[model samples]
Target: MSTHPLIGWAVVHPWPAAGIAAATLAVLGAALWVTVRTARAIAWPPGPVLVAGTGALVCTGFGADTSWRFARDGLGMTDTTERAVLFAAGEIALFACAVMARANKTATSTDDAAGTTGVPGILVWAITGALVVPCYATSGIVGGTIRAFFGPVCAALLWHLAMGLEIRVARPEALSTGLPAVVGRELRERLLSRFGLANRDRTAEQITRDRAVDRAVHLAAVLELHPDGALSGYRRRRLAAAVARSGAGTNGEQRHRLLQQLAARRTSGQLATVPLASPWAGTPVPDEAYPRTPLGVTGAQLRTMDPLAAVRLVRAAHPEDSPAEVAALCTGYGVPVSETQVRIALRAGNQVAAAPAAPRPVLASEPEPVLGAGLRLDVESTALVHPEVQSRVPVLAAAGTRTRQVHARVPADDQTEPQHTAVPDAAHPVPAVPEYAVPHNEDIPESDRDVPDPDPLIEQARTEYGTAVPSYRALKTRYGIGQARAQRIRDALGGTT
Candidate 1:
């Protein structure tokens, strides 16, 4: 049996063989370090590492074996030492190419960082490995060795060039000359189908119609929830783009028509309408539902009023009004009271019968007919005036004239004749009536107040529970409060638990 060229060389040149082995181990360690570092830098998976490592090993082993075999066969050179030297050189060149590729990839900009290379490590190695036998067979020792060294370098460059060309050619859209109309249409349909926007079984006309209907429905929903005025220009453009991408019209005429239809349906009472103050702020209220009325209160003032208080005030003014009508009345007053809140107030009112009607106070006759028209006091005013008015009324009275007597007819059981009290008017001022004398529903329990202060309860909860408070249910149980109040307390506590 003939001794292997490497084994025979090792026997004669033991020191050189040892140095070569050391260099091989050093190259392997370097390759491993580079692979791991590059993989981490680019966030690559272990698959690329395994693939590159296997490629490096296969290329080195195969190229060296092929070089030895070709030289022994006297295809280019019969010198064993030259064959061995060329084999080692080829192995080193292949590894150098791999390291260079990885280093170049790592040095790329952050925007181009990749988890995988454009040309895979395995294919590059295989091409370079296969080139080894041909280079040595075609040329003598000196020329062959040079070719072997440069073959892997050239292979790496060619691989990158091939990848770039493939990418550019693969994009049909990048071609300067357009494709045939039919081919372009087919490509568009294929792309749409891949993205689930088109169906193979459906005709293009049917697809376009379906997409238009979908866009119409989406626009209708958006308008139904948010008025066109509420949508920003960017948001409107985005929505328009979305609609246009679906093959729908871009002018928003369809959206306007949809809004008209939705408004008509809500006006006809076919669809439930939301309050204009809340989720539907900028939406126009239907004329039939919210008739314009001079309610003397602005939307800003109404919004400031407690929702329950607004409901009660509107209900008192229109006792015969339904919950919807009461809500409409408040809406007319510039308040956005939902029908649901009116309904709740009405239900609570039913449980508690209406309070006894107070006697109408007779206004003292003015000496010279006080300037400005007659003061119009809303029916609920005698019961519950807003604090803003309450404070302002006293200040106005203090600035006006002297005291005037106002007679109020009392019940026969209490007094046969009418009772007299000093009252304030525009021309004649008297000491402001005591706040307690106001005929409000004082008989109602303290707990039944429309709005309660949440601060004290929130503070107490924090003191008791520390940083991590229990759920609202636990708070409700401990505080003996309603679910809403407990929730408010928990929310105020930052919802720790």
Candidate 2:
């Protein structure tokens, strides 16, 4: 009934109806395959839907093919290409409608559970279907058959453009849901820096070596969060880092001073005071600001007091000062509070002067050395913990050297002339006086004393009575510390009147 197009084209002859139809269908199938490949993955949209939809479109295309055959053979309509093109275009339209319907059905079924949705599905269906419209219309317009194809092409184009319009209409709905995530992530990092959360993995030796980059990253995170600088977050982080560095060293005095300053602000409200030149001026102040609490005169007040009294005073003033800070502070002033002693003082409501722990006496585990007359001996070791040697060696060393005493009552003018008779005694044998027989104290075992405890009472009172009490409580609860500590606070005695 028709010649093959290839055979016709080879001889430079015009293609017959069947040849034209066959060539048109072959090209359309290849284009559809390419369109589907570009629009969605076989893995993503599921292979079955693409396959089923494609089969339907192809079947519809065959309807156009049969129609064209009828027009060319049964009715004497000779434009084979135009007939084939219209059939392909109509089938593509039907295919597009089927893809959209299938996609919509899938979307509705999975909407609640889908991690991401709607846009991807619609894009897949719309773009695939729309790509075919032009190819089909171009086929239909062949051999001057333009009028019959324009309507369907326009309708497909209109449907394809609707996806962009819908996105604009829906954008407002997503703004609220997305904003909190952006804001919260930024805020929490800044807050943590303000609180000075330390990394757990660092060793004292590592920090002493100044390999503190891990600590620095956290500080940077805080700065990023506090960009507007409305809060004192930056200062808090700096203070915390300084305190941490100070605690892990022999030169802890400076760190203790900083901590004391921090404590002073918390208790006496001295450091928290905003002088007339206040930066955070808009913040409300009380109508009658109380006068600063006096911490008493320095050395004179401390001299006659109970040993633990100073520790309590520091605790009462600076409840937030770390144990290291308090110990270092007391150590700076020659107060000798152990780290544990400082902690206990802080816990006892800053009332009982921290009790001094008695030094354990060293037992006489070794034999005493005998000293010959006129041959004084002394030995000293830097380690001071040996009980007998602790007091004995230092005393012997000091006693070995005599004070400026009258050397034999320095010959009172004439009376010393009789002393020359002593030269005769060497023959009488002042039996070999041993050359400074100083015995070394064997090395003492290293003391494994525990550092003193921190005061929980002042800390608890500060929580109950501090200026930002509610906020502090909220932080405690959030961090999983219970409200019982808050309830037991001495500062909360009168409750929030």
Please give each candidate's TM-score: 0.22, 0.16
Evaluate model 2: give its TM-score: 0.16
Q: Give the CA lDDT, 0 to 100, for residue 481 in model 1.
A: 61
Candidate 1, which segments miss by more than 4 Å at Cα? 1-48, 112-497
Report model 1's TM-score to 2 decimal places. Answer: 0.22
Kindly list the per-residue Cα lDDT of model 2 for residues 292-398, writing each as its tens digit.
22475364455456767887776666678787787776665556678878767666334456789999998877653435533333444443343321222134555
For each candidate, C-alpha RMSD in Å? Answer: 33.7, 40.7
Clashes of each: 0, 14
Whole-model lDDT, model 1: 0.57
Candidate 1, 228-255: lDDT as tens digits: 5666555567656655564445436555
lDDT of 2 at 19: 81
Q: How does residue 208 of candidate 2 score in lDDT?
A: 47
